[model samples]
Structure formats: C-alpha cells, structure tokens
Target: MGDEIRTILEQYALQNAVKHQDVPRAGAVIGAILGKHAELRSRAKELNAIIGSVLAGVEALTHEEREARLAEIAPDLIASMHEKREKSSDLPPLPDAEGGVVMRFAPNPSGPLHLGHARASILNDYYVRRYGGSYIYRIEDTDPKRVVPEAYEMVREDLEWLGIAISDIVYQSDRLGIYYEYARRIIGIGGAYVCTCEAERFRELKLAKKACPCRDLTVEENLLRWEQMLDGTFIEGEATVRIRTEIDHPDPAIRDFSAMRIVNTTLHPRVDATVYPLMNFSVAIDDHLLGMTHVIRGKDHIANTRRQKYIFDYFGWKPPHYLHYGRMSIEGLVLSTSSMHQGIADGTFTGWDDIRLGTLRAMARRGIRPEAVRAAVIEIGCGGTDISFSWDNLFAKNRELIDKGSDRYFFVQDPVHLTVKDGPEQTAHAPLYPGDEERGYRTITFNGEILIPGKEMEGNDLIRLKDLFNIRVTGENTAVYAGDSLTEIRAAKGPIIQWLPPDQTVPCRILTPEGIISGVCEAGVAGCVGETIQFERFGFVRIDAVADGCVTAYFTHR
Candidate 1:
C-alpha cells in the first residue's frame, strides 16, 4: 500500500507540475489522489505522508530539471493528461437532461464566425452530444441590409472545422410564412398592434411611458393593416407590428417592442418578402416550433429574453430553459465584425485569415487546432462572469496539442556566414523530433561552412552546433574546429546554436505578428507546404505557400 501510494503521488505531482509549469501543491496532490482512490479516504494521514515525500523530491529540482526528469520517467503523461482534460470538462451538466433534448446554434449571417461566436456554437454542440440530443444549425439572416451572402457558406465551413455536426439545418429566410401566421394570430388575439408612427415619435412615447395612439386600434383594424403590410401597401419603415406589454414596465424598451417590420426584399440575400420578423419574434417562434428544450446565449440578450417571455405568455406556450453566459473578450483584439470587414476592404488587413485577426479562420490559418479552441472554451464553461484572457492563454493550449507532431528545422534570419577552418567534412543527421527516433532523421552535409543568425553569434566565443559538433569562434566571422567531444561541450555549458549548411538551404519568409521576417532555412523545409514545424530557438510556424524558389510560412508562437 505504501509503495502504491508513493507511485501515485509521484505521477500526480509530475502531471500537476507540467500542467501549471510550477511546483506542485501538496494539497492539490492529496485531493487528486483521494479523488481517484476513494478507499483511501479514511487514510488521509498516510496519503499526506506520501504526498509530502513526493513534493519534496519535486521541489528539490529546478523547473527545467523537473521537466526533463518527468519526460524521462513519464514520456506519455502530458499527452494523456490532455486527453483527460478534454474528456473531463468542468462544464456542469444540464439540469434534468434526460430524453429528447434539442438545441440549436442560430447565427446571424452578418459576418464570418469569430471566436466569440465559436463559444456559443461549441457549448451548444457539447451539451447536445452529452445528452444524446439533436443539434440544429440555423441561419438567422432576417436583416437584409447587413447580411453577407458569402458568410452563409463561411459559417458552415467554420462549424464543420470545429467538428460540430448539424443534425438539422434551418434558414429563417425560408420561414417568412410561419412568422406571418404567428404575427397574425398575435394581432387577432389583441396581443399585438400595428403602429405607423415615425421612429422619433415611438422613441418619445417609449421614454415618456406613453402608448402610441395606434396601440388601442381594434383587432380587426390591426388585421387589415397587417394584410396591407404583406401586400406591399406599406413601404420600408412605414409601419411595424409591435407586441403590447405593460406601459409602465420598469424597462421602457420593453413597453412595446417591434415584432415585425418592412424591409426591401430586393436588398436581402435570400428571401423575397417586404415584411420581415425581427430577432425576438422569429427566435421565439422558431424555438417553440422546433421543439428546442434549452437556449444558450450571451447575457447581452437578457432584454431579448424578457421580451420573448412575454410573447410566450401571450401564446400560452412554455419558454425553453435559458442559459446565459457573460461576454468573452480576447486581450488586444477588437472582435467587431464591421471593423474586420472594413479593415479587409481597405487593405489594412490582408484578409480574414490574417494572423492578427481573432476569427476562427485566422486561428486555423495560424496553425491553432480546433480542438485547442474547443478545450479552452470548455475549460471556461458557462460562467456568468465575463472572461478576459490574452492570446498567450490560447497559444499555451495550442502548444500542447501540436508540440509532439511539429518537426524541428533550422532557420536563420539575416544570415551571417561563418567559415570554420580545419573542420572535418561529414554528414550531420538531425532527428525530425527529439526523442521520437522512429520518425527518422533529416541529413545535411557540411563542408565546414554554415550560416547562423547574426544575433546568436553575438558574445559567444564558444558554441555548439546543435546535434552536430562544437566550434570555437576565433574571430568576428570565422571559427576553428573544437574537437568533437560531447562531454567537454556539456561541461563548458555553452549556448547551443542552430546552423544550416550554406549550400543546403532554401529561401524562406515567415509572416510573424509583427511583420514579415525574410531568411534562409534548411533544405529539408522545401517540400513541407502547409506543414507546421519549429524553427529551432525561434518559434513554431505553419508553411502557408511554396512558390518562386521560396517557402512562406506564418509564425504561430514560440
């Protein structure tokens, strides 16, 4: 029992340390052990002894040393932990989730799906899968003036990339008749009124807690006006159908909200109807009709929720359960769709897939795996508190997912030629991935001349050419052979610098967040278009294109 407990503690401590990049806490280790071994609950004193012993061993080593030791003992632990984290999300289970739960991701096709939009999509997809329910994809493209025809396909592609399967798809544009029928029913029941008042007048009445004169029109009169609205009798913005609420309601905006209005169908991307239903009206009708049992959206829609509840009450229908999470903001990013569109149009941005943009398309182009985004958002769960995090948080998650697969290569920007005299001619073999021997190696022959980064050559009289041999920098741009002794090299503790044979190199350019970095990379990188690899001591980059004797890649992160 003592040996088993100690082993478990060591594993947990290494896992905890690697995950947080810090010393493992004694309390956390004990809790993890207790969670996995409930039978040890009564043996708290014994477990603490094991935990303390393990923590002491871990704390005695430096961060790098701890990492190296953990890698040696538990090579697969980090990947296993990632799989566990992905499986065991902290999101709370839906209340009373049982049979036949239906959910939907209804996106307005005004622009491409950004990171903020992805959160809602991922949450809905996750819960639906958890409960063995149906997932629906709906495009709420009712606002013609703001709709982008191309965005419809972009949304589909984005959702597909995120691994969200749509069991059913719906477009609000095709449901105009359904909305019209419901609107007429509300009008006949005296629950809604047609108002022809100007926008300015309606604002005045709403602010002053007064009802428009048209609010008291008889049901028959409103029905006649509704027919005129559908018959092209009402020009755009000439009239609107408003749902009636208490005039003295504390929230003046809810005094009487517009249920449907007139928009020029000619301007719309898909539909050809003069009268269109607004979001609150269309969403309420669709949620009830489609049998959606739960609705997940941002808290910014709280007012919309209240308005929809009124519509449900008027129709004697039960509203779906609502889960509203707070808004999430990416540090140093303006996630406004309008701003992104304008920036792309004006050449301020290269395109939607620009590394600096926060759209899912951009993230994908930058080699950020969709699984990483899903896992990060799931870790956040459906909290009501606003989430603010930097890009580093996202990159940290991505690094774990891609680290094992990314092959290593040498790239030197602003190359400084170094000539080594009296050096033996030999072929240097570098492994594609460290500790992954089965992946094989990339070979480069050196004739004693190489190109290294100018910055790395500074203040270093003695340096090791990584995976090859040692060199002593005798002058500014020259070097002499330092005998091939790995022990002496390690004892000296010199900086290990990446080098590329001058003749076995290819022109390369990296698009970093700052700007384009032009350089030369090892010849092995020539055929790896669209492959993500690490530029040793520089950063991870995704090869975007290969053309014109040059390989172009987008820098992901360090």
Candidate 2:
C-alpha cells in the first residue's frame, strides 16, 4: 500500500487494536499501532456513524410517511451535511490545504473576459486558493466558429490583470478520447442512443408532444452509427447521439436531447485533431475526469445540468455540487455569447466592454467594479433559467456601491474663455473628488485670465472655480469665447465647480478595449492605464494605455 494508505491503516488499526490482557509487552504493541493509526481510527468512527445513520434512515423510509418525515426535517438536512467549511482570507491560497477542493474557471473564449467572467474567475480562484485546492483553467471552446485564439488570450490577460494565477490549464479539445470513452460507457449503460431524425423532425416531435422514431434505436445499431459518424460515413446533421430520457417529465429539458453531432466544420480549435465535437458530452466526461468538485456557473446553463447529471449517473460518478448564478442580461436583449460576438462585429457595440452591451467586460468598462457585480449576482440569486433583466436595477446597484468610496472630477463639456479685467485673482482650489478626506485640494490659478462660461463677461463680477474661492472679476478688455465652451451662463444658483490647472500635464487619449476615448485631466489624476476611476461630471473612465504625452481612456457614460 502507498504511504498515505499504510499510515492510515496503521493509525486506525492501533486505535481499535485488541486490548492486552496478557502483559505490558502486548499493550505496548497495540499502543504503537494506535499511535500510528490514530487519524484513520477517528475517520473510521465518523464513517461508521454516517453509514449507520444512512442505513437507519433507509430502513425507516421503507415504511409509510417517510417522505413526510423527510419534508419536516428538510430545512435542517443540508445544514447537518458537513464536509469542510474553511474559508481562505487571501487571494491565491494553496489548493491542497482546502480539504481537496478542486475548482475550475471554464470560459467559452468567444470574447474577452467581461464583468461576469471576472467575477466567476475571481470567485473560483479565491475559493481554490483559500482551501489550498487546485484551480484549473479550462477552455470551453467546443463550438467551432466561436473559439478564437484572441478570445483565449484575452481570457488569460483579464485574469492576470486581476491577479488570479491558475495552474493546470486543461482544454476540452485535448480530452476528446476520454469523452468518447465515457460516451461509449454511457451507451452501454443504455442511457444514450443514436438518433437519425432531422432538426425539424425533432422540433415537430416536440411541438406534437411525441417522441421521435430514432429515440428507440437498439444499442448495437446506435454504437455502429456512432462509429460511422466518427468515420465520416454519416453526414453532418444526418445523425446525432441522443441521451435516452423521460419525455413527459414536466420539464422540457429532460426530454431526450442530442449529446453529440457533426458540425461539419474544420475551423474548430480542436478540430485539427479530428475528434468528437459536442459540448454536453465533452463537458460531462471532462469534468468527471478532472475531478471537479463543484460546478458554479450562470443559471442559463442549469438545463444542461440535468442532462449532465444523467451522464454522471450512467457513468456511476457522483455529480459535483452544482451552483447556478444569474446571468448578465438587459431589457430587450439576451446575453447570449453568440449574440454578444455579433454585436461586437456589427458595431452594435464597440467591443465586449461596450457599456451598452450588457456583457460582463462591458459592464466593467462601463464602471461596474468586479466586487459590485458579484454582489449584484448574489442579491439577484439564482432563479431557474429564464430571466428578464432591467438596466435600471443593475445601474442602481452599481451606483450605490460606487457612490460610497469613489471620488469625483469636473469635466466641462464646452469650456469658455473669460479675460478678467483688473481682478484680485487669487488661486482657487478644491479636492480632486468630493468627500475625500485624505485627498488634498488641487489649486487652479485665476491670474486675471479666468475662462468663465461666457463671451460677454464684462457685466459678470464673480468667477467661481467650484468648491474653491469665488473670485471677483474686474473689467474686460475685448472678451472672446473659445467657441467650444458654453456661452450662455445663468446667474449663480448652486455651488461653483472645480477645474484642473491648464498647465497640469493631463492625458489626451485613453484607449480601451471598447474604443478610443479622449482623456480630460492628468493621466494619474483621472486614472492609470488599465485602471478605473470616476470623472467628476463625465461618469466612469477606464485608462487603457499611455503614449507620448497622451493617455487613452474610455468614458463609461452614467
């Protein structure tokens, strides 16, 4: 036996060893085994208790009213079910220390990691790190057309950006043989079969509320057809592997569905290897083989979970703990991965981070922090698959979280000119953002050359720099408007605003993944490259990159 098993045996044997009635010599030998096998003995006792309880429960359930009793105690059932609940307080904790917790962040790699992806990735990374568990980075690139190297690269970049380090990168493409093996095993178990019905026929069957003819194929024929599909004898869409399941199970998803199909495309990232090409079957097998302990993903995939559980049952592998969370959606739009990619290409969105796209990356670019998004997901919880989202609700959550700690900056849409006549031009200054106790004020010089909001500023007396001192304007020598600044200035009715000194070195352009955006203030003051900050009046800004005396930033409109 291996050291771990041997040590375990010894420890358990020592603890439960026969008591010595003979002498001290016998006692010493038993004591030695007890010392070595103490841990296993404890584990054995715990396992025995659990087994006994389960057996007793089964025996009791054979009698009547068992369901009623279970229902009565169901509230406390999960609470009583314990494995381990140790929480890691740091990012990237050791995997082995976490009671063998294994986590995976599987991204489709169709586009960049959005806010949703970031949240999911971070959660998995954190949990795995905390428990000292293995954090596996898996590429869910089963779809041929959607899988792109750029998308995969961006996934890696986004994670590194957020300080998440993943080991054991596994691709679904590399594990096709394992998936096919499991599929054959499942078919042998009579849980899967080959279907020759066309797509429309299956649709008609669903609409007519009946099972398709291909649903009852014999195991031998089905296996032969599966081989034919692999050998290219069966044309694409001509045949598919469908899992045998109940049709009238109340839920439409439980109805027999295709497990594998030929998409007839060589563009797949993994297609170069000429292997199996379906998502559900590949995921089901790969997850089991990888020893995934829990599957945390969007609720939209919950339907797939039922089918996957069936696969797990057919293979005699325990289905992992499945945790479904809400997807990022908006009114009049579905957050489908295909749709998002189309939006990116069609200019319906600038890119994945397009604030209007409702993508997680777009959400992040639009000023929604990763933490805020996760909190929102938690608040929304998981509600089946179908969900109707309102942009207002998500914005409200973001606004609440951002308003607390983020500072604000001033951004005048149309800046004007004002030549103050003989004025007492004291320097006006204000904090970079409101409610910032630690941030000192930024000073702006009036210097008899104040760019107030009007061309005809002869009659105007005061020039308020906003949150700073209100300066008294002297006479003007021929005032001229800059043509860009707002000309019409009303009488003061509210607090004046703040402005950066014209001489301050501010970034000019902030380029983001979404698109290019002009920067207003100093590069560091507004935001650093790849950093997020709130512009006082213009909403959130993400600093993309910096170049010769210019910085690229994307404005996330409020």
Say which candidate scores most in TM-score: 1
lDDT of 1: 0.85
Top model number, lDDT: 1
How many residue pairs clash in model 2?
32
Among all windows of 10 consecutive residues in model 1, the one with the lowest summed lDDT is 57-66
TM-score of 1: 0.85
In model 1, the clashing pairs are none
- How accurate locally, in lDDT, is each candidate? 0.85, 0.58
TM-score of 2: 0.64
**Can you give the lDDT of residue 137 in candidate 2?**
88
Question: Total clashing residue pairs per candidate?
Answer: 0, 32
Sliding window of 10 residues with minimal summed lDDT for model 2: 481-490
